[model samples]
Target chain A: MWETVLSALMDPVNALFLVGGVAGGIVVGALPGLTATMALALMLPFTFSMSPEPALIMLGGIYIGAIYGGSISAILINTPGTPSSIATTFDGYPMTRQGKPEQALVTAAFSSGIGGVLGGLTLLFLSPALADLALQFGPPEFFWVAIFGLTIIATLSAGSLLKGMIGGCLGLMLSTVGIAPIGGESRFTFGFSPLQGGLDLVVMLIGLFCIPEVLAMVDRKRVAKQGLALKREKGVAGGVIKKLVRQPLLLLRSSIVGIITGIIPGAGGNIASLLSYDLAVRFDKKHKDYGKGRMEGVVASEASNNAEVGGSLVPLLSLGIPGAAPAAVLMGALLIQGITPGPDLYTRYPDLVYTFIIAFIIANFVMFVMAFYGARYVARMIDLPADVLLPMIVMLTVIGSFAIRNSYLDVCMMLGFGIAGYFLKKVGFEPGPIVLGIILGPIAETGLAQSMLLGQAEGGVWQIFFTRPITLVLIVLSLISLLSAVYIQTSRAGWKAGRRDAETCDAD
Target chain B: MRRRLNREIGVSLFFLGIAVIAFIQVEGLNRMSAVFPRTLAVILLVLSGILLVQSLVRPPEKKKGETPLASSRILPFLLILVLYAVLIAGLGFLIATILFAGVGTWYLCDRNKIRAIIGSILLGILFYALFRFVFLVPFPGI
Candidate 1:
């Protein structure tokens, strides 16, 4: 293992890919409206030719870099480069306003690197044990896990529970448009040959995530004319390191929060960082200074979000289930390479797993170095005009969709989904749950069919669900996730209503 | 609020329609193949019904007067995307991309005809180089 790691590090080609992936990732991450998942989706077709190890290494680099890179724009323009960095904008932008942008940038970089490394270490050590646990999962348990993932994600993503579930159902329906998983029958092709193949997950992902973003760019073109450029003090980040040293526990706790959140199938970086920020504020003695340019807020948000990169990969590496959306895309990329991720991944290919882990750790260091030196140049990606940027993104998405199977049918599918996604997004339905549905639909179907067959052989169909301890645990977790999502969403809505009432009373 | 409720109700109806269609499709399939999708369709139908009822009970507050796709400018942009997709395979990727980017930039970004044309061509070449040359994607035309 050490020899392979050494060879990977020594291999000039591997080094180039690592650096190139991080650089590309940072550019994508620093650009507003571009996400880590979209970056991976765009890059997936290209990775098709490469071997699995280098392919994963490059993807891993992008994942880590993109997550950390989001902080750059969050600190500079108050707009998070990615959704995960949304919390960073709270304190980061304020620091920039105070002419302490360097401080915020440094803290974010340091924390992201630290958090990412810690998370990567967690993946390295913990994935094997998790894979061992996953081996106990039978077909019924697998079905339950998929259901738990789909329901929780769908229920949690949208502002309204109904809309989220609708999105999930819509995705499941889309996945069912091709052939039946169990029985050899065409389902919903409507007499089109392309429909027989079904909607490609990559095509759907690009269309759902990238196309609407392009349309949004056009829609907001007039409003998005403003450019953000900030001045930086090069050596100022040194002081942030000293300050961060004093609060080791906060960083550790935030990374742990990120890791745990990442392990949960649907919980992602945005949730991880926000939860970490809330914990930081709740536990801090200087809570009042939290939203007001405090360094701790920057640290907690950046650390947790960066850490989420590693955390999210844990499930993808162990079980076939993706821990987050980006990881889902990564899983798709793996599947494209004919590398199905499951418990067998760790056992069947320990070298690939170990090498990828090492590459992930190395990518963090590369991101740290690049972010430290290249912040000024990479941050300029914000100034690229929407007209140019949007069209360029459109070009890539169109071509990328076609490249999936060299099929124009996929391109049309992408455009159709993109338009639908744009409208769906406006109506309060999130695309996240929909993506989850598409990814998990086949898994659930196969498991359900196989479990039913097993059940018939044993006793009864209904007994399979209740007899398994794992299934029961999954059901309980699903219930908790659904209930908590409801509680949080309703409370937020109520609070908004209360504020509106207060304002109305004051006006009266 | 009424507008939002209308949208939600419409969306719910759409889902319900899809559920009905899916249920019908599942009817002819074997039990192994039919069970999962049928179950999903029923779940979707129930969920859609719940959504419709909720929207009727409590409509959300509206902040904007217009819907997202209501802008007069949006239809042309969308039409251009569809036209581009329809034309790309016949026109070749490079030509299609250049045309799409050029026209899209002219309409969506800058009206300067020369700048839009030149900039679009440059972007087209750049993308071609990256995907075709660097990434080796063989995007149907160099």
Candidate 2:
């Protein structure tokens, strides 16, 4: 592993690609509406022809860079470039407004690098052990794991539980459109040949997230504004280092939150960022400064979100289940390279895996350097005119949509989803749940059915789930998560009611 | 009051109708068909029922204001996409891309005619050169 890592570092071409990928990823990520997933999807054709090591390295660079790039917009403008950056805006914009934009940028870079390095190290050491344990899992255990992922419905639901469940069910129904998993039977093709393959997840994501956003932007006549001008400081490096030393615990706690959330298959960087930000607020001695521009908030959000990249890959490498949407796309890229993920991945391609881990560490380092030097220029993107930016994005989206498989059907799908997304948003349905559902739905279904079939051959459904200790443990955990979500919602409602009653009494 | 109730009822009826249609489709499938779709359809039916009931119980949130200009602006964009799709098969990637980029820039950006034309032509050539010379993507032909 050490030799592989050494060789990867020594290889000039690999290093060059890593730098290029990080740079490109940062540019792509800094652009609003150009998601990391879209960047990977657009780059898929290019990566198809490259060697597996360089390809994986490039993709890894993009993943890390894009995750960090989102903070640029979050800090400069109020809009988060990616969903994961939503929490960053809480403190990032406030910092910008306080004329500490450079300080915020430096803090973001430092925390992002620290979190990323920690996550990469976790992947390096823990993956082998996790892979070994994963070797014991069969269809039954996998089914339970998928069920556990579905249990995230409890956490994701913002409104009525029933509505969330209904939305999830709708997502499941959409997934059933292509073909039957068990047999080769075409179930819901509706006689259209394109429907045979069902809706592509990338198309679904682009439609659900991007289309609605573009429509909203057009509606509001939204224009990008020049960010708060700050005095050019020479000591950004010194400032970042000083803050790192001062907020060691905050960085550590946020990184841990990011890692744990990333390890969970359904909870991606978005959730990790939010969870870390919430914790930072709770832990801070001066909580009043939280939404009003605290450096701790910036550290917590950026560090945790970047850490999720490492966390998400753990499941992808060990279990063949992706930890997030972009990870799912990465998994697809891996499959295209003829590299199947699971226990065999460790045994068969130890060197490549090692190379990937080393490259991830290198990618974070590259991002740190880029962010340090390029912060001035990247910050300027916040002021780009929407009229110019939107058209360019639309052009790219069209080209990307068409480029996949060179199919016009995909173009049509993109446009259709764009319109559908616009309406869904207007109706108050969040696309986050929908995107999660689309990605996870097929995996959950396939696992459940296969496990049930195997169980019936053995004895019964209950025996199948209960017999395996690991499955039992996962099942129990899922129930606990569901219960906890319900408890939180109930307590929140109670608190709100109490506050309302007190206000009423005071008024009277 | 009547208008609001009418809209809710219409939405509910539409979903219920789709559920019925889905159920009928499922019934037509052979017994050998997997249990998953049938199960999914049944779930959808139940969901549609719930959505229907909810619509009746609670008035839909009244959305404020007119639709965004982008929704209307999308038609021209869609036409450009359609043109690219149709022409790409015949003209090949390079020509189709050039045409798409050129026309799309002019139509969507709202730039002056000369600027639009120049911008489109430059974008086309740039994409062509990058994909062909740099990335070796093999755009079809002239």
Candidate 3:
């Protein structure tokens, strides 16, 4: 572990990718419409052709960086670049109104850095134990785990639960397009020979996530927003840091809130930050003072969101279950690298796992450094014309899909999915549950099928599936997840800041 | 503005069709392969069925003004994407991208011939070089 950490730190290429991911993620996250998930999806092609360590390193950096970057727009422009920073606007924008934009930015940056590192530490320490526990998961347990993931994401990620489940079923059907996982027979090819391989996960990812956003941006291009001016002030960051250092518990509490929220599959950073901000208000000496230019508000919101990044990765690394959408994309990256994340990940590739975690913590520091110095310039990226950004991203999707197999067919399929995804989004089907379904489909199918074969000897199918202690626990959890999502939707009149929407799901 | 289909009713019917198609298709597969898909097909059918029934029972929620980023150009933009993909197979990656980017920028956003021409050329060249050189990604066409 020490050797891997040292090598990751000492390597120039690793440092470069980590820094670049951080800077790029911050810019994308601050762009309001662009999200960590889309950024990760766009960055997917870049990773497929590279080795595992650097890919994981860069993705970790981007995840942490983008979560913090949302706070920048929240502060200056009164818009969250990503949904995760919606809470930041409460006090962050007020701070901007008070001529303390730079101070607020620094406060956010500092708290995010501290929160992110703490959260990464939690992942570094906790994932091994989780992996050990997951090693106990058999075919039945794994099947239930997949079901749990699909249920949680579907209900939490979409506005309409029925529609979300339909989307999940759609994704499951898409996953079946090529060969049957267990039977090894071509199932849904519909006589298209090329589809015998099914859709490329990366291609679908680029299509489903990127293309919809590009078109959506085009639709909104007419509604223009102007940014507020940012002035550089000396010692602004220094003052914010010194003040934040005095309230260690506040930062720790917010980060804890973020970590716990992140561990619950569908509760994303937006939820984490809101819950943290609420807790801060309850404990704050002047209870009614939050959302009125309180630095603690910005700190709590930013810290929890960034920390959620680390907290979210724990499940992805240990159980192959992504806690959020960005983590889902990260799982795709892991798949691209020929690494299936699960219990064996710790045993088989200890070096890559350790390097990724340590590099993740290091990326937060890099993000802090870049955000402190380059926040103003990065804010200017939101100004780039949608026409340019859209076309460029379209080109990226073309090349990104093409590069994976050097196949124009994949590009066309990507475009097809993009078009379908656009129409799907128009009708309120989000990419979150679809992506989850696609990821979990193979796992669930193989788990159940294999369990069926095992049950031939172990008495009966019900005994195999329902009799296990672990499977029972997972079944109960899946029920709870589905019920809670239903209750939350029915109880609340409106969803705020899209707690599990595409962007906020990656707000992890 | 053109009259639009009732989204709730329309989406439910569309998904219902998909569910039927999926279930019918699963019948031709081996029993082993069909089991899982068959299960999903039923789920889709039931879910879409529930959605349709619910849509009929409840009044569709009235949409508020300023539906975030609503636009009429999506269908036209999708046509552009199809054209772009087709052009890639014939025109080759570079030339196709140049035409797509150039025309897309000019009509879609820039609306300035000079800037569109220059910007598209620059973008086309930059991406061509990156894919051609930095990544060494092979383009299938000329």
In terms of DockQ, the best-performing candidate is 1
Q: Candidate 2: lDDT of B132?
A: 57
- The residue-by-residue lDDT of candidate 3 on B23-100, one tens digit each, is 888786776688888899888889988887887777456554535333666667777789999999998989989888
Could you tell me every candidate's TM-score relative to the true structure?
0.94, 0.86, 0.94
Query: What local lDDT score does residue B33 receive in model 3, on the 0 to 100 scale?
Result: 84
DockQ of each: 0.64, 0.32, 0.61
Find the 10 residues in a row with the least total lDDT in model 2 chain A.
A154-163
Rank the models by TM-score, top first: 1, 3, 2
Model 3, range A404-441, lDDT digits (tens) per residue? 78898999888888878877887778887787788888
- Judged by TM-score, which candidate is best? 1
What TM-score does chain B alone reach in each candidate, compared with the true chain B? 0.89, 0.68, 0.87
Off by over 4 Å in 1: A222-235, A487-508, B64-67, B140-142
Docking class of 1: medium
- Model 1, span B20-137: residue lDDT tens: 9989988878888788889989999999998878778877677644555446767788888988887787888889889988988899765879878998899999988888887777
Worst 10 residues of 3 chain A by lDDT: A491-500
lDDT of 3 at A99: 87
DockQ of 1: 0.64
The per-prediction tally of clashing pairs is: 0, 1, 2
